[model samples]
Target: MLIRKALIEDLNNIMNIIANAINDMESKGIYQWDNTYPNEKIFSNDIFKNNLYLYVDKNIIHGIIVLNEHQEDEYESLKWKYISGNHLIVHRLCVDPKYQGKGVAKDLMKFAEKYAKENNYESIRLDAFSQNERACKLYENFGYNKVGIVTFRKGDFYCFEKRLIKYGS
Candidate 1:
């Protein structure tokens, strides 16, 4: 498997993955990502700016992460600052439904961490819908601690953070 920067051509695949994710989450009572937000504009801008990260296996995009150099504009007033300088914010992270439970998401996250480290970032921060218990559990299991909660256009989501520094240092 290889992780690389996303390009304009990958937008459709990423859209399908995220669309399916939203539908699946709704089916499971998790109201995250509807017809709004994360639309073409967001994806287009990310691809244009080369801010999207992708994980590929056998030349297929399995997972995609829309990352930014700093906190998203919507999160500016929420006190969601990252203590670490040059922190990369994980805006949207979704794996193809077919690739779920295959550690693809975890691997993508690790790639993000590595990318941040190489660029001098000290940590990464992200948030997920409060109703998405599976994602919450996944983040927790991956060592992300709940920093707080914030409400977005869809609903409230738990904020999480993972420091890159050594434990208890």
Candidate 2:
């Protein structure tokens, strides 16, 4: 498997994987994402703005992720705070449902941690929908500690952060 920066040409394929993943989630009673999350305009903007990354295996995109360099102002003003300094905020971490249960999310997270460490970021942060118990557990088991909560369009999400040391120490 290969993890690399996403290119404009990879947009449609990535979006399809996203759509299918959402549908699978919905079927499982997980309300994380749906059609509205990846409207045409949003995917177009993400491609044009260069905010996405993809995981490829044998030339197929099996996972997708969006990263933000800073926390939004609303999160910034919240009562809870991060460990310190700049953080790479992760969003829309979706693995193709076809490739589910194969550690894809863990691979993406390791990639994010390396990305942050190399860029001098102090930590990696993300929010899991409160109702998505599986995601919440995954975050905790992956070394992220819950620091607070924030409400998003779907619902309130538990915020988590994993501090990164220079060499994974």
Candidate 3:
């Protein structure tokens, strides 16, 4: 599997993965996503900003994520551990339903951490749906400290932060 910068041509495939994720989440009673939140416009903006990434295997996209400094507006109210300096925020992390338990999301996250370390980012911040137990556990297992909770379009989300200075320092 290869993870690289997303291109405009990959938008449809990316959206398909996201759609699968939405369906999976809905079937599991996780209301974290819907038709409106992560639309094509948002993905397009990420592509335009050069922050979106894709996880591919044999030229087939299986996962998508965004690594950048952009943070949710509600994140400002939280008291993060490493507040100063450049920090990479993980957003739009989703894997195709077919690749869900195959560690696709984990691979994307590892890539994001490596990207942050390479770019001298001091920390990594992200939010997982409070109701998405699997995601919350994944972040915790990855050593992210849950600092607070914030509400997004759907509902409550747990904000997590992990310092990268040990790797980047």
Candidate 4:
């Protein structure tokens, strides 16, 4: 599989992946996403900003991840460990339901980490739905530290941060 920046032509495939993910999540009792959030407009903006990426195999998109500096206003109140440097925030990470449990999300995360480090980012931040055990575990297992909680329309989410650069050496 190859991870690359998303192009305008990949929007439909990206949306299909997201729609499948949303349906699967809802079926499994995870209401973290819905029709209102993660709409096409938001993804269009992500693509336009050059922050969207796709995990593809043989030209078929399997997963997507959005990395940028934008964070919710609620993050301002959270006590983050890496407070004084450029940070990459992860958003809208999703995989097609057919590709779930196949390390697609993990691969996307690996890509995000590499991209952040290569781009001189000091840390990476994200918020996982409190009820999404799979996502929470993925972040925790990947060594992300739980910093705080942020409440959105769906519910409270656990804010996590992973520092990529140490102070010395």
Number of the top candidate by lDDT? 4
Q: Residues 68-164, candidate 4, lDDT per residue (tens digit)?
A: 9999999999999898789999999998999889999999998899888888889999999999999999999999999999999999999999999
lDDT of 4 at 78: 95
lDDT of 1 by residue, 1-169 (tens): 9988888888788888889888887788777887787787888898888888898999999988877766655555555445646667887888888899999988987877777676766777889889888888988988888888778777788888777763344
The estimated TM-scores of all candidates read: 0.88, 0.90, 0.96, 0.96
User: What lDDT score belongs to each candidate, Candidate 1 first?
Assistant: 0.80, 0.81, 0.90, 0.92
Error of 2 at 129 (Å): 0.8
Q: Which ten residues in a row have the lowest lDDT in candidate 1?
A: 75-84
Residue pairs in candidate 1 whose N, alpha carbon or C atoms collide under 3 angstroms: none
Over the stretch 127-146, how does candidate 2's per-residue lDDT look in tens digits?
A: 88898887888889989988
Q: Candidate 3 on 71-167: residue-level lDDT in tens?
A: 8789889999897779999998998889789988888888988899888888999999999999999999889999999988798999999998546
Kindly provide the TM-score of model 4 when superposed on the true structure, using C-alpha atoms: 0.96
lDDT of 3 at 48: 91
Task: Indicate the residue-level lDDT of 30 in model 3.
Answer: 97
Clashing pairs in 2: none
Candidate 4: list runs displaced more than 4 Å.
166-168
